[model samples]
Target: MTGKNMKNDIVNKKDLKQLVIRFYGKLREDKILGHFFNHVTPVNWNEHIKMMYGFWENVLFFTGDYSGDPMRKHVAIHKKHPFSLSDFTHWNKLFIETVDEMYKGENAEIIKQRAQSISTIMQIKLFK
Candidate 1:
């Protein structure tokens, strides 16, 4: 792959969106996260996907598409329910699985590592 082509691949956005959709598509059926969605607006599944895409894009690429602090959001979510490390570990695993099932590349590995790091950090903070 040439430099320009590699740049184009990284510029792609669908991977992020797909991961969000598939992850939540599962989350909507998950025993843990599913129940919490009861408070969600439920009218903006597409919007939520975009938000998640922007979030991962920014976090993994420094693109700045995401403006909110994910840790803070997780903390707020934790306030409503005690989030365990196992939950985040499972979430990261699902996220990585979705990405792997969708795309195969070095970028996928980067996203996986970042997701795991984020989940680990959040898990530690939530526990503390």
Candidate 2:
């Protein structure tokens, strides 16, 4: 890829924040997932986005900016909406697609892998 056309790697919070914002934007429009956030859970976008930035930053960079129980939160959501296997699969697809569209490098790859792992773990715990 040339200089102007090439996408950069995720190197800091700013880049990760962009990824999160864009991913959520896509998620909010998705037919399968949009209802979960728009109606079922009805997230506070401002607060949720901020928390997600911290969450993902900590995940990718070990920044320790986040310190919440994500499992507990997801469990709450599951109680409300009851997640299916397809929900997790679609979430991972959108996440990986968003990451690939915006960035490319080690951190980008790591984030995608981590997302897959998270989805798998969450599914196992939530279903079992």
Candidate 3:
């Protein structure tokens, strides 16, 4: 199962982990979002990775292991600075590329489409 299989219509856990790792790897390298993770007080990268894995697990895999409020968390993060549409666009583009790089499955289209839809919805929710 490729990363595409773990998303959208095809859900799986391993693929979710791949997605999270790849996406965060890109985030760490990306100048736009890399600054946010600069201070990991205790620097427990393992715990941080697990937290992210669990979050994406719940989101992309429907795993019951995660039960936190992402919207609230996003709001908190966004409060530090305004997140513009361009930022979201960059995020979506990176996400799509990561997915494409890791997998090639039928559900890829669904995953990308839903991602765009949700990003737009979140932008609306975030802005107004």
Candidate with top TM-score is 2
Per-residue lDDT tens digits for candidate 3, residues 1-120, read 555464343357766677778788787778876666654222255666778788655555466377777677567767876677888889999988987876656655566677787788
RMSD of 2: 1.1
Worst 10 residues of 2 by lDDT: 57-66
Clashes of 3: 0
The lDDT-based order of candidates, best leading, equals 2, 1, 3
lDDT of 1 by residue, 14-115 (tens): 656666788888877778667655453243666766787788778767674778787887778778777776777778777777777766677877888887
Ranked by TM-score, top first: 2, 1, 3
lDDT score, candidate 3, position 61: 49
Q: How many backbone clashes does candidate 1 have?
A: 0
lDDT of 1: 0.71
Q: Give stretches of model 3 more than 4 Å off.
A: 1-11, 39-45
Off by over 4 Å in 2: none
The estimated TM-scores of all candidates read 0.79, 0.95, 0.74
On a 0 to 100 scale, what is the lDDT of residue 43 in model 3? 26
